[model samples]
Target: MKMKISCKPIAAAAALLLGGCMVGPDYHRPQVNVPATYSELPGWTQAQPADADAPKGAWWTGFNDPLLNELEPQVAVSNQTVAQDYANYQEALAEVKVARSALFPTIGVTGSGTRQRASAGSTSSSFTRSVGSGAQIVNSGSLEGNVSWDLDLWGSVRRTIEENSATAQASEATLANATLSEQIALATAVIDLRTSDANIDLLQATVKAYEHFLEVVSNQDKYGTVAPSDVVTARTQLENARASLIALGIARAQNAHAIAVLVGKNPEELNIPHSAAMPTLPTVPVGVPSTILQRRPDIATAERQMAAENATIGIAVAAYYPTVSLSALDGFTQSPLGGLLHVANYVWSLGGSATETIFDGGERSGEVAAAKANYQAAVANYRGTVLTAFEDVENDLSGLRILAEQADALDTAVRDATHGTEIAFNEYQAGTVDYTTVATAQATQLADQQTALSVQQSRLLDAASLIGDLGGGWSDSQLHDPRNPDKPPAQPAAASAASAPAAQTSSATGQGAQPAVQ
Candidate 1:
């Protein structure tokens, strides 16, 4: 008998396996128009395609900053945003497991024993007759087990699993994106702090020059060689230069505080160097725009969301189909203690059921429509993200190019300003020019130096933006592979193992390009 029952379950499972088919429109990545080369920038060099399996991790190391390299990994493990997304990804994974569990049978066991007493005068004389002259006691015991399973006739459970799995993948991508963003912020803050220090140094030098001019003017006025008005102008210039130095300190302090936060330290704990240590901006390899589909985490996240929405449509459509279920109960029951273990007291039941919703007030149809609409919205968002990514990279490229040219021009200006100041000082000492002329030349020199520093900082920021927009050379293998969908996801250990060979290849070939920064 047990064999017969098992046969029915086996046959049902086989039928279900053969009949199941994933419904709804399958997900296919939307076609995007991509240019072979960026047209917005002239003389842009494209990176040659390397071996498909190459390690690009720790792209930040190209900057050669030991501190930054050490801090980068902490973002993935400890940053609040990344931690939150990791929790979300785990939750989605559990949901997928929950949905998949519905495909199997559920078994439950129950046992009970009871005793009851009846009063003699509780009923009519017939009830008394049934109980007999003396008090009668009745006792019963039973143990039972039930098995139930829902036959997924329309693939609803499968679709649910699919949707949840895709959502989990999206959450994983979110974690990666958060890490990328934090690293970029850390690098930018560091560069800004250094720029501030450089500017302050320039301002300090200017203030000293102004003080010297004020002393010279005072001497000339005492000797009646210069008017009182000229002395007043010299004093005012010195005061203004001092004020400028104070203002520069404000920004430098704020930038230092920002860096402290990024490194997971308190502002008071941070001790950045007072002098400038200019960061190097690495030369980024601009790959093809088509590669953007796989490289950018936000873009990958959008694509995964689309997959989830597509699966939801299938789930909604399945609501129109009937549901089938099988149930069975087996047990033994006896009224007497001696008969409790007898086979004659055994009881069993088995059944199957089918349910079909005849009317739903158009709710099911509305659900299907909503799912379709959501899928369309996801597709639009994905395209927009891709376009935005392209624009960001191109914009940074243009910025770096123009800033490079500006820095060159500023270099020449600083040299010319220094020469003018020297000549002006010589003439002032010879009594051919007023003290005011020397002060003006000194101010010009300071402004030129500060401007040059500002341009360098801008160049560094643009470099950071370019690296970020290009996804920091992140590999597609971290997310999904379009070429081999059946391959299991690369675990951390597996990823590390795979990356080793690529690292070796990169080292051997010397194909690794450093960041372009001075």
Candidate 2:
């Protein structure tokens, strides 16, 4: 018997599969309401293109603190949180390759050898049928190769690839966000440590002044020129001053420990010597609110998450279509172990099959609806992230503006209080006033000085926070796609346009339009 097979039907089906329609909504970034300008921008200094002193490289360098500059860079490399995010990003990148592998065919090879003993009288079809009753040995060998492909006629594999790629980009943005946050934390800790040092110096000076006042009061009490209560009051004031100076050590040590951890070190490993220098407050440039969309890494992370969720909808919609699969097998088989590769023993087959679900109890519909709802949620989250970024920037700007005015007032009050304290002490020595007046004046001077130092610390803290809220020199354009990590990342506008739903309509060759990446 001879069998004849026709390839025309399979070829025609392949053409139809290639030109099949991908039934689902393509991804488009949802519209968002963005403000034209920030409400707190009025008092902030706007950066000019030609300003030579504007912060150029790392924003932390603008503070001009040698220790901060040295420590801040280490956060990106050594901070445990940042290292964990980086590892997650690498895993996401590998997942993209895993998803893309579904787009191509799978190839496999198999080889086998078999030997068996069979009774000769079992089923004889030879010329001398039913002549022999003894057992016979048979040897057989086979080798085969197969190729199978689950054709992506409805763009399911393409959608899966798109989803994984977007996830990878989101993970990359997450890594950036983590690094920026740790760096900001490091800068803030250093500022606190320096403020503690400054406070310690101020308190030490006040303690010395209090001791001198105590000495003068004790001498007068011994000569009967002052009341015995005056000696008690003087000793009480000096002891209180000493106690306040000792309390400052707690804050300074805690701040140092926090800085060490921020830079990925143990508290005991890093020893920060007492520095007389304070960090200079840097002028953070406030741009229009729209710029935050591109500058903030958290916003970028949210946007990429939206794109990934959008692709999931397409994947779910694909399940509604029938699945088509193509397969091919080629090999040689022989009854004996000799000449297995001969043309007489060659065998080949080409086949294709399609399966359509007749009944699924509405499972497919539920999946599609769930995917769409998830995408909508992602869109809402993205918009919320953007709104929150604007809020952060506005709050930082307002705090800095008001704190600057308060700093000036405190400076003037400190000088006047110092002069008042000197006059009160002289009046007490000349017997024109009681020792109580001297004690009150000294307390006022110390209070005013401490308030001034506190105001300075607040201003420096606000500067660091403002810089961080401004994105700490990060940009969305730095988010690299895993597929082409060496190439520059596409701009947000261009990437959105490329993956727009309107542009996706024309592609049906199982090669859907993809998100833009350089």
Candidate 3:
């Protein structure tokens, strides 16, 4: 009958072990819209899904610029912004370790020593004691250890660990996003500087042509063949051209300073030499629109946040159930040091307790409600982020297309303007046109040349922006996922713009080439 009574507690423990199920809803990837092919990508073949397994392509190399190759890698190593994100990732990694510790029992030790004397007249439990040497000296010592464990019968600890792991994964995505942002920024700044250099070159050449025109005008005035005002107009045009040429230095200097800061150098520490050849625009082969979710860090971040929020629901639900606590104590005591290790002095005990929240004024209910609301919000945010990413890629594709057409038309205008300038100069020599006419033609030619150069600059900038909009080669896999990597297999080249169908694309895979610019 006593054995039958003891079996009851064992039956309860068995029930607890078998009945455990995580209380909250398990995470499932939220449904969101993903387009078939980019509306802006006309006449281009979409890469098959198998292509995503190809190496993540190097988009910057598509530009074919040597200088960019040298500068872009520096942002990862020395840039302060990237460094800050790296440190943040490390902190998240540490937090994962912290959350995991709850799964194990905790141990503590205690020790004490004491000395005392008992009165000679004392009695033991009302029984008379004979006086021995007037008083008896006594000494005692102890060493003890205790163990306690909060059994995860309700899955609270498991839920907490899941929450932390998801949060850490989100942090990893943020770091990748920051690092990519800075790299693209540095690349854009360099493009701007190169553009400025090209424009300055154009203006300087105009200045030289204006100087020659001024010489011809002065000779005519000396011979009294043209009026004094004619000489004054040519002199003004030459001076204006020189002023414009010199003013461009300000922009060039400032852009150089900006590049210096990006690479973690002082403003004056770096200098880029003038190069006439701009990097060739790589045809950015924007594969299909569906893959963008795999490579985008911001999107990855949002999805992870949703996952983290989902775990909190389980944690809140667990709070409504009882918590099981188990503890054990073991110690040794002796009057003399020699007897401390003997089993005769051993002391031990084991016990288990359970606590239930019978009433809490609806606090637990409110908490559960709040957790659900937060999860819903995260889902909305994740969907919104996906939409925004698709829009970004589309914008870049459209921009590059239009800019290319504009560049061709401007090239024709510059050539016609040059012809007009030559004809006006020949008319002046024949004395059929005044110096003012030649000056006007010269200004028109300079203006057209400047416009053409600016278009070239614009084309380069749009290309760089396209690369940025496409995710700059970052993968979702780079983040820490101890139990399972959330992202897809490494993206094929140019997949920095990659996204997975099931929210499993890595943030750091796919070093393959990007979409080609048409």
Q: Pick the candidate with the highest TM-score.
A: 2
Best by lDDT: 2
Which candidate would rank higher by lDDT, 1 or 3?
A: 3
Tens digits of per-residue lDDT, candidate 1, 1-518, equal 12124647556785676467766776787787776655443333222332233225677776666657777777777667677777887787777778777877887777887665555544333212345665544566787777888878778887887788888788778878877888899888767877777777777777787778778778978998777887898898889878888998888889888766765678898677685566776645555566666778888899899899999999999989888898888877765334665678778898999999999999999999999999999989988998998898778767776786688799999999999999998897788987678778887888899889889989888877777887776644576432234776664333322222110111223545322233
Ranking by lDDT: 2, 3, 1
Pairs that collide, model 2: none
Question: For model 1, what is the alpha-carbon lDDT of residue 401?
Answer: 64
Off by over 4 Å in 2: 1-21, 43-53, 120-137, 490-518
TM-score of each: 0.84, 0.87, 0.84
Model 1 TM-score on a 0 to 1 scale: 0.84
Q: How far off is residue 239 in model 2, in Å?
A: 1.6
**Total clashing residue pairs per candidate?**
6, 0, 43
After superposition, the stretches of candidate 3 with alpha carbons farther than 4 Å from their true spots are 1-20, 44-57, 114-139, 335-338, 483-518
Residue lDDT tens for model 2, 160-190: 8788989998999899888888888888888
Give one digit per residue, the lDDT tens place, for model 3 in 1-518: 00112335645764575456778888998888887877765443343333344323356776778878888888878889888888987887777777767766666777887656667744232222344787655556877777776777877777887888888888888877887788778778878887787888788788888888889889888999998998899999989888887888899888888888888899878978887766776554455676677668889989999999999999999999989888777888766444665778788778899999999999999999999999999999999999998988778767766676676688888898899999999999899999889988998889888887777777777767766666665657555574444654443444333432111111233543233343
Cα lDDT of candidate 2 equals: 0.78
**TM-score of candidate 3 to 2 decimals:** 0.84
